[model samples]
Target: MYDHRKLGRELGLFDTDPLIGAGLPYWLPDGAVVRHSLEDYIRTVERRAGYQHVYSPALGKRALYEISGHWAHYDEDMYPPMDVGGEQVVLRPSLCPHHAVMYRSRSHSYRELPLRMAELGAMYRSELSGVLGGLTRVRCIHLNDAHIFCTLDQVADEAAAALALIGSAYRAMGITDARYRLSLPGAGGKYVAAPDMWARASKILGEVLDRAGVPYEAVEGEAAFYGPKIDIQVGDHAGRESTLSTVQVDFHQPEQFDLHYIGADGARHRPVMVHRSIIGSVERAVAHLIEQHGGAFPAWLAPVQVAVLPISDAQEATAARLRDRCLDADLRVRILSAQDGSLGARVRETRLVPYQFVIGPAEADDDAVAVRLRDGRRLPALPAGDVIARVRALVQAHDTRLWD
Candidate 1:
């Protein structure tokens, strides 16, 4: 098994300092590059899907989670309410309660039947010290979260649409080795005992999965406190399945929080809410990518896409010019000065970068550079302008390939 923590450390992506506390990741510059790129990609995908982005506070009053039933149902995993100037508050563990409050912030009409709200929310959990493992299990998390408040008649379609969105994202990320689990309330006290609501919501979710042509296994006792959910399990390089994405249909929250919308009849009616996270944790996703691809990220997601190496001090000017050109073309690149390392040493370092180029007297005189790809394929000298344009297109298109 490829251990992401070890790989991440070796790749200089992120670090966890014991002094700062366990499970908190501090992203180095390289890691931030990848993190920012992934967030941008997700935002682009979400905006195109009609999601209205929003930001919510990271902490809330204890009564907030109580209203959402998390305090009662999931207290063990949550930190005890903190005393902030005599007021008891909690470091938010989930984005649902805040989002629910946002939904209740203003009255809504039936026209806003499927009001989808999203956020890059932060959450805190009280994981047992022994149980905390890298990004997968953590105290702090940056959640890629969203909530859809819809009418009962719109729930099924909205559920199906959520599944489609998750499926599209997985496909785009080349995550094909996965399965679905439809989790329902089981024999545990973990779930809220709204039996009638559970039956209705579970049936609706099952129907959505069936209509969407997705295969799923019914898992007992895995549903959230609010409702039933469809959790997608993606396998790592070693085939160990882990939950990656989820679409949770919430029934208890809407009723508990009294979230409603004006119907066509001008009467107040409860709006059902669905909580979905296509990418559960940005930190965990980076960790997963590290292990999945052995830290050799695709061109679009690699921290450093290209490295420019000068053959000798004589080629320093050419390397400098090429570096400027790469930057002007918006390519995430670095130039290897002669003082940095030997040409051979720098070439070996290109394993971390998808593409690398060598500039020397002949090539510089010809206004060209010799290219080397991650796969050890060395190509003939090509014009600097042509190389710049080629890499830019690959980056803009999010191409996985190192070369066109």
Candidate 2:
């Protein structure tokens, strides 16, 4: 098994200081770059998919969640509300309620039936100290969350679209053999969702999956309090199933929040809500990627895609020049010009770096680089421009098979 906590320490991805607290990971530089890459990628996809990104406070008034029904149903898993300055507030554990408030703040027409509001929002969850693990089970999380407000008629299409987005993202990340679970409300559970609404919501989700020919198992009592959900189950490095993504239908929130839009008949009508997350936690996603690809992230996601090692003091100037040029070309490159380390030592230290170049006396004289790949392939001396061009192409195209 590829353990992320072990590798995270060795690779300088993240760290947890007891003084700071448990389940809170401080992202190191290398780890931050990977997360930024993922954030950028997901944001691009969301933009193309017509999601309007927004920002909301991580702390909200207790009355906000109360109005959304989370205070009554999910209060146990939430941080206790505290009085800050004057009024009582709680660190938000989910982004949906905040987003629902945003929707109700505005008046919309039927033309905006499918309003996709998104945010890379921070959330806080109250977890037992023992269960707090690495990025996977953290008390604080940056959630890739969004909520879609649409008419009841648009529910099936939106549900299918969310599922398609999940499938495409997993494919791009090289995650394979992931299964789907259609989670439904059961007779026994702390469900805020009404019984009649539960049956209708579950039936709608079933029809959406059936019409799309997606095979999924309907599990009783696995549904969220708002409604049933379509959960994407991906196996971790240890072969345990983890729910990394979800598409949930919420029939209660809009009603509780009194969200309304002008109908085609020009009357106020309630809109159905679809809560979706392609990746629940950005930190955990990076952790999973590190394990999935064994820390040799695809060129696009690798923090330092290439490192330049000067064979000797004589090659330091040339190495600096090459590194600067790669940087100008927007390529992630590192210059290892420390004379204390030998060529072999530096090379070994950078084994996890996707690509590395050796600047020897001969290569420096020719103004070229002797390229080495993480997969152990050696390439002939290539001009700096060619190296940058190849790497830039791979990054732009999100290509993983660099050697092939």
lDDT for each residue of candidate 1 in 1-404, tens digit (9 for 90 to 100) = 47887888888888898998988878988889988988888888889889999999999999898889999999998888889999889999899999999899998999987999999879998888886767766889898999999988888988888888877766555555678999888887888887899999999999998998878899988888779999988666556677778898888999999999998898999999988988778977777777777888878888888899988899998888888888898888898888888889888877778889888889989999899998788989999899889989988776677785
Query: Candidate 2: which pairs clash?
Result: none
Instruction: Give the worst 10-residue stretch by lDDT in candidate 2.
Output: 233-242
Which parts of model 2 are misplaced by more than 4 Å?
211-215, 237-239, 338-340
lDDT per prediction?
A: 0.86, 0.86
TM-score, one value per model: 0.94, 0.93
RMSD from true fold, candidate 1: 2.0
Global Cα RMSD, each model: 2.0, 2.0
